[model samples]
Target: MKNRNIDFSMVLALTVHDMKNSLGMLLNSLDELRMENENTFDDSSKFNTLQYEAERIHNDLVQLLGIYRLGENNLSAHVEEHFVPDFLSEHLARHTPLLKGLDIECSIVAEDINGFFDADLLTGVLNNTINNAIRYTKTRIRLTANEQDGYLVIGVEDDGEGYPEHMQHSGTLSFKSLDFNTGSTSLGLLFVSAVADLHCEGERTGHIKLHNGGPLGGGVFELWLP
Candidate 1:
């Protein structure tokens, strides 16, 4: 008979999964409360702050789970073709809870193009971007999807201050090379980089890029998928 050994990794993964589920429930509760008092609490900073913090916790747990997956040899992408505009629309819907009013407007532009990506993985990647953008965007956010030089290029742009100079690299910067001096190494960046690394085709792999100035003339996040 084989001995049943306790796997610490599995334990930790389960723990994180539980924490994520609990955080999700909390977010849902907040959503219900906000809906019930939409008019009465319109532009309520307190509710928004609580929701943002809950989302941050949810994202952190997701990234932690992603790190666990990246360390395993079995991690892989579940790719599928999706209509660009529709995909972006659905992604935006997920953040409607957080983007109530505040004079912020969001729109998507895609011209009958389609992109092949792992929906769930990209959702996590976009979750980080949307959360971060909502905090910094002044009045507008734009999402664009198009084909560029044999790759599917998806961009998230905002009309606010752009990325710091240190992060404006051409491609996904290595985690080891990130600015650890300020202890600001973005866990979201690391998670998205790993997800991009898991997707590959014919010597081409997905990658993330940070840049300033797009249609919005502000911070732009581009995810390129081969």
Candidate 2:
């Protein structure tokens, strides 16, 4: 008899892919339910909780798949030019329902400018960041984008208790340093960092910055793309 070895990473990727698809279907159903009971669901905390949790899980699965691809060197930014304000507005629109249900006032403040970067990758990064902001924001969240020092700076600011001092830093974060046991794995940051690093122009590559104090007076997450 011969023994065969199994590829655990492959198995995990396949499982996560399946889970992501299933969650997509679940989200669609949730959206349908919300539409059917629009008046009641908007004011129902339980419905809001269900939508929030489902969206969070969907985002997690997306990040996991992205991380897996990064490890395999199969992920790269497909940079393209995009109108900043319109891009930000469309992304925020997807979460309007959930944001309204939570009574969180979300808005975009991007200037009239064009950015050159992978839209899909940026969407993934923003999806996770916005969801995190929704989780902690008291009553307001702002999405802003503008050019600074020859780089495009996109920020997510929330009026929640700012990021802990330990997480406040600049540069691309390493997944190796993440502590899963702490309940704050910072996995989203890792994925964001990976996406940011993929954008490059000349000697400048992208990176992420975490700090406190913005228009929101809370955590500010900025992605700098060159």
Best by lDDT: 2
Q: What is the lDDT of residue 143 in candidate 1?
A: 85
Q: Write the per-residue lDDT of candidate 2 for residues 114-183, one digit (tens) a residue.
A: 9999999999999999999999899999999999999999999999999999999899888888998899
Q: Give the TM-scores of the predictions, in the order they appear.
A: 0.92, 0.97
RMSD per model, one decimal:
2.7, 1.1
RMSD (CA, Å), candidate 1 to true, equals 2.7
At residue 83, give the lDDT of candidate 2: 95
Counting only residues 3 or more apart in sequence or on different chains, how many pairs clash (N, Cα, C under 3 Å) in candidate 1?
0
Worst 10 residues of 2 by lDDT: 1-10
Error of 1 at 72 (Å): 1.8
Residue lDDT tens for model 1, 160-203:
89999987855665668766678877778888888887778899
Q: In terms of TM-score, which candidate is strongest?
A: 2
The residue ranges of model 2 lying beyond 4 angstroms of the native Cα positions read: none
